[model samples]
Target: MADNTAINIENIYKKYNALLEGHFLLSSGNHTKFYLQSAKVLEYPQIAQKLALSLAALIKEHSIEVECVCSPALGGILAGYELARALGVRFIFTERVNSEMMLRRGFQVTKGEKVLICEDIITTGGSALESAQCVAQQEAKIVAFAGLANRGFCKAILPNNQKGNEGSKIQAQSPICKLPLSLPLFALANFSFDIYPADSCPLCKDSIAYKPGSRN
Candidate 1:
C-alpha cells in the first residue's frame, strides 16, 4: 500500500470533479455540500490501482498482519480486491441478506484468520461493522480497518459493540486516514431538519428545489 499521508486527497478530488454532485443524502443520512463518488475512481482501473497501493502502504506502516481482506458487498468489494492484491492476500465480500450483511455462496472466514475490513467510504461506519461482525462470527480477529476517505464525522459505531459505550464516541479510525479530497463549501448545520424530509419538508414549503442524489 502507498502512504496515505503522501497521497494528496485534494488531487484525487480535482481529478474526479466531474463525477461529484451537490445536495446529496449520504449513507449516513446527513446532507452535505460535498459528495464523494468513490465509483468514479474505482471505475478507472489506474486510479483504483493507485488508491490500493496507497492503502497497502498504510497497512504495512501500521504493521497489521492481515491474512485476508473482507469488505461489505456493493461498494467495498472492488477496493478490497485491489487492497488484497496489493498485499498478496485473499479477498472476500459480504452481502446484505434480509437487511443483515452476511457471507454467502460458500464464502467463509476461517477461525483465527486475521481479517481487515475495507470500505469505499466511512460514513456512519455501518457497513464496515457488518463486515466485521460477519468475520467475527467465524471467530476471526479484525486486524485493522482501511478506508479511502474519512469524512470528519464524530462517533463511528463498530459492529457487535453497539451495546457497549466505550470508544464509540471517537470518530475516524482508518489505518490510512485521508482527509476528504474536497472541502465543504457550505455548512448545512444552519439548515433545519424539517427542510430536507422526503415530503412536507420545510425546504419544500419554502419552494427550495429538492435535489435528489445517490451513491450510484
Candidate 2:
C-alpha cells in the first residue's frame, strides 16, 4: 500500500461490501451517515491474508519492530492473528470480562516485549487503550497500534462523550497515529463520517435510525 492508504481502503471496502451508507446507530450510541462492517471484508481468508501483508509492509517501512500482535477480543481476533502471521510473530488477545479488558485463557506476555495492538476498526481508541493497558500490566512495551480501518477521530469533543467529560483527552493519539492529525492510528485506510448527537441528529428527526452492527 502507498503512503495515502485511504484510496486503497475505499477500493477494498467497496469490493468486499464492507462499507455501508445510511443512518446508523453506532456501537458508541452516536449516529453516523456511514458504517464500516470490517467483518465482511475479513471473512475471506485469502482477502484477510492480503490485507495483513499490506499492513505488515507498512509496519516494516516504518522500521518499527513488533515482537507480537495483541488485539482486543471478538472483533480484533482474526485481524490480529492474520497480522501476526504476516509479521511472523506470536499473537494473543484481551477480552472484556465484566466489561473490563483482561488477558484470560492462560495468555501471557513477557516483560519488555515489543507489542503492537491490532483492531479491525479504531474509532475512539478507548478499547485499544484498554488492551494496551493490559499489555502494560505485564510490563510489555506497546510499540504502536495498527488497525484495518481508522475512523479518524483524534480531536473533537461532544456533550455525549461516553468515556468522560475530560475535555482534552482526544489529542493523546498525536504521537501514535501517522494519519493526518490523528494518533497511534496506523490503518490500511482512513474514514471520516459526520456523527451527531441524538437531539441534533437529522435521522432521529426522520425516525429512521437503523442499527446495522452484529452486536446489536
Best by lDDT: 2
Estimate the lDDT of model 1: 0.62
Give lDDT tens digits, candidate 1, residues 4-57: 454555467558762354455555444544566677778889888877887676
Pairs that collide, model 1 = 1-53, 1-56, 1-57, 2-53, 2-54, 2-57
Estimate TM-scores for all models: 0.71, 0.80
How many collisions per candidate? 6, 5
lDDT of model 2 at residue 101?
A: 89
**Model 2 worst lDDT run, 10 consecutive residues:** 156-165
| Candidate 2 lDDT for residue 68 | 89
Query: What is the Cα root-mean-square deviation between model 1 and the actual structure?
Result: 9.3
Per-candidate local distance difference test: 0.62, 0.75
